[model samples]
Target: MASTDNALKTASVLAFERKLDPSDGLFHAGNWDGRDDTTAWKPVTLREKSVRGTISNRLKTKDQDPAKLDAAIENPNLQTVDVATLPADADTLRVGFTLRILGGTGRPSACNNAAYQTKLLSTVQGYVDANGFGELGRRYAHNLANARFLWRNRIGAEQVEVRIQHLEKGQPKTSWTFDALQLSLRDFQTPNGVEKDINSLADVITTGLAGKGHVLLQVTAFARIGAGQEVYPSQELILDKATSKKSKTLYDVQGIAGIHSQKLGNALRTIDTWHSEADTLGPIAVEPYGSVTTLGKACRKPTDKLDFYNLLDGWLLKDKAPPPDQQHFVMAILVRGGVFGEAGKD
Candidate 1:
């Protein structure tokens, strides 16, 4: 029989997701692409078009005027494409990623058993580091792991969060297994650099956007099945939400409709409704290549009592539903006049 706790088995599966499109491509995105001519690093920029591709054509100066020779020689240097100078509309791109751990060969452990688990995690890190993951970049150790042991590196575009947990309850005498492993990159760092934490990655995104006034997201998903059929990718999703909540809130409070709190409030309310309905009416089949359509309230503020007009307080994850608490889950809060956007709203 499947225990009530059987669902928790899947909890151990970690899923990480992020958006991976920077408004520009020529500059730094998330992690370094290891492609720069100056430092064995060439920035990973999504190339939509190119004027030249062949070396034979590149050296074809046969019909040039002598006066134009110097200019043409310099033309190769001038042939560079400046992604930074691209139009603002170019920021519209996003990506998605997913990683999962099917059951391990051995038994598993409890989530609270931090001591022994740490050592086991280190062993895994050493394995990954010794055996590089190619373009997936290097593995990094996380907090629960020995803070330095290292897990694999990945990039995601948007519309997701990273989750990790134990595959089961009792301490396993031999081994442990994970169910899901996924990450969502908030910005395009490098398609191949390591980010130790979600916070650090988020910081990179917020900083880049603040300076460039735009951002892009790219997502990649690695799926492994059987022996060979194990890699696939998805189209990018662009985040068009211009202007930070901070800037918009300021103008909004000042009667500037563009930055109005009412709009923010409305957005939150919408999120709340949509989320609530999905939870109640779902087993929403949110699978790959499947439409992720849902109707729910936006991010909202919960009230003292159950007020229909007020914002929703939180959400309920089928996996994280409480035990004896009997209370509804609270997702996020909307401050009456709280900090809307300093950074990391997600």
Candidate 2:
């Protein structure tokens, strides 16, 4: 696979001390009076804890691997792995992992689940807890000794390898296990310069597409990549008879077609109108109309046009906003909404 300039490879280690049962591995919320010797405070204890594992990547690859380089070439799909991890609250903890192709290199088409390394080394999280009656104090322990990664290769050969060893004291040398393992890749841009590493990009498109000015796209989102650039939908379009045979109505459609209401459409339009007005008005000082207030106290109170822009800019840009001017960028987008201006002060 041809790697992207932003591919990153890293490992995360998490540790949770063991907890006692009955509380089911959670610390109770109520506060007790330590001064009241008359009352007994059910001594809350920690017996077991868990760590989540993740691996992310953003590598590019060509449609066909070079025959000469196939042996040594490691594609993003080849490195993505998924393993189960134990949950602290439940008797059985399960962890899920997946690999994704952020972009493509030589190949015009994108990559999927087939290219990852077949060998995955994962172990169930387990530990022993003993206090000798709580006076000497209890201990939740597990050693990392002999932890291994196991997976199969494309040729169907089973591969098992050790990654950590000796996790706990006074336990069987082979008793250590892991809950889950994940791998992801992405580019890392820094202030000193662009330092691209293999790290997994967030599934921001699916998770945050419902908000204003954002649309879910399949091809175009992957196509735009350059220095100091942002990801955005090429355009927004509604389905019509020529496009979708269902002939669903919009803004006031029926049944499944009408899942979104006219009230919402009008609200969206109002938001759009405000943004458009802001471009010329500079800023607004009026209370917002429609459902803007429903966002609750978490919404920023814009005192100027820039304030309004700053508020919605994060939502406009799916990924993290660039620093220094990020706030300025945010204010600028909101300013387009025509909702606020420089004269407004609240």
Candidate 3:
């Protein structure tokens, strides 16, 4: 039997503020008002038309099976032709967003392990301070240059150019140019050959939507097999208008098993932190003016709950390193559901 510890799980909360087309339920970047300044970075929603076209082209070319091709084209969820294609303009879809390392519960952000979290933060900061978000930009560049975002990236994409806006306040905007055809043939490899550069496309899309005021994207990753050493995003749900029953047009794509689209009213409730249950750990909870040695079952305040970092610190103090599965679990709970920033909310 597979151990529960090995199960892959992840929790993420991506909030965005942007304008949406009431008629088509499409995202519009130019209409962003920038009302919320809560997070350090914001995401610009890319046109669904572009996303659809890109996906469709890739699918048709790569999959030789006629039935699968038809399914890809006919399925409303997978079909990109329904939306009108717009000309690329000044409002290009920029790829970049600030990824928070701490979850609402002070756990590792995105359910990443302590080691991964430490490396990501330190590496990103080092690059940002020295060269100004260049490493991130390169990753974005590699994605666009290789058309790795396409649903069928292995096949290749036609001429494509992606413009990445700098996350830093004063840095200049830059464009990463690449020929999809050339990138397809190039045998690019990361320092560690275990993972490919193109694999980051999923991360790029999930993070890019952080600022799109309309949609709330929550991703969860957990071990599905073995000792749960490797975690992968098992669920990526989109809370949008198409899935809402109140809307006149229902864009339900049942074939795409896990993509959830719900009305804004229902979606907001998923991440509502105001009325969340307190998740606590440790033998005795810390309380104000409480006796620590008393047997009256000490409890820690919700705000005082230990996050992933703190939990890791506690584990380190014991001279015992957390196993991979435990690390993933700790991080998952931190982001499971609840507002991290609000005091006593989780």
TM-score winner: 3
> How do the residues 134-215 of candidate 2 rate in per-residue lDDT, one tens digit apiece?
1101001100011011111101212111121221233322221221111100111122211111110112211221121222
Q: Give the alpha carbon lDDT tens digit for every residue of 13-102 in model 1.
A: 222221121111112112212112233322223232234432324555687787776665554321222121112322111112111111
Q: What are the Cα lDDT values of the candidates? A: 0.23, 0.20, 0.28
Candidate 1's TM-score reads: 0.19
Which 10 residues in a row give candidate 1 its minimum summed lDDT? 141-150
Instruction: State the lDDT at 154 in candidate 3.
Output: 24
Off-target runs (Cα >4 Å) in candidate 2 are 1-254, 257-292, 302-306, 309-346
Best by lDDT: 3
Cα error, candidate 2, residue 53 (Å): 47
Alpha carbon deviation, residue 29, candidate 2 (Å): 41
- lDDT measured at residue 80 in model 2 versus the true structure, 0 to 100: 19
RMSD of each: 22.6, 30.0, 19.7
Ranking by lDDT: 3, 1, 2
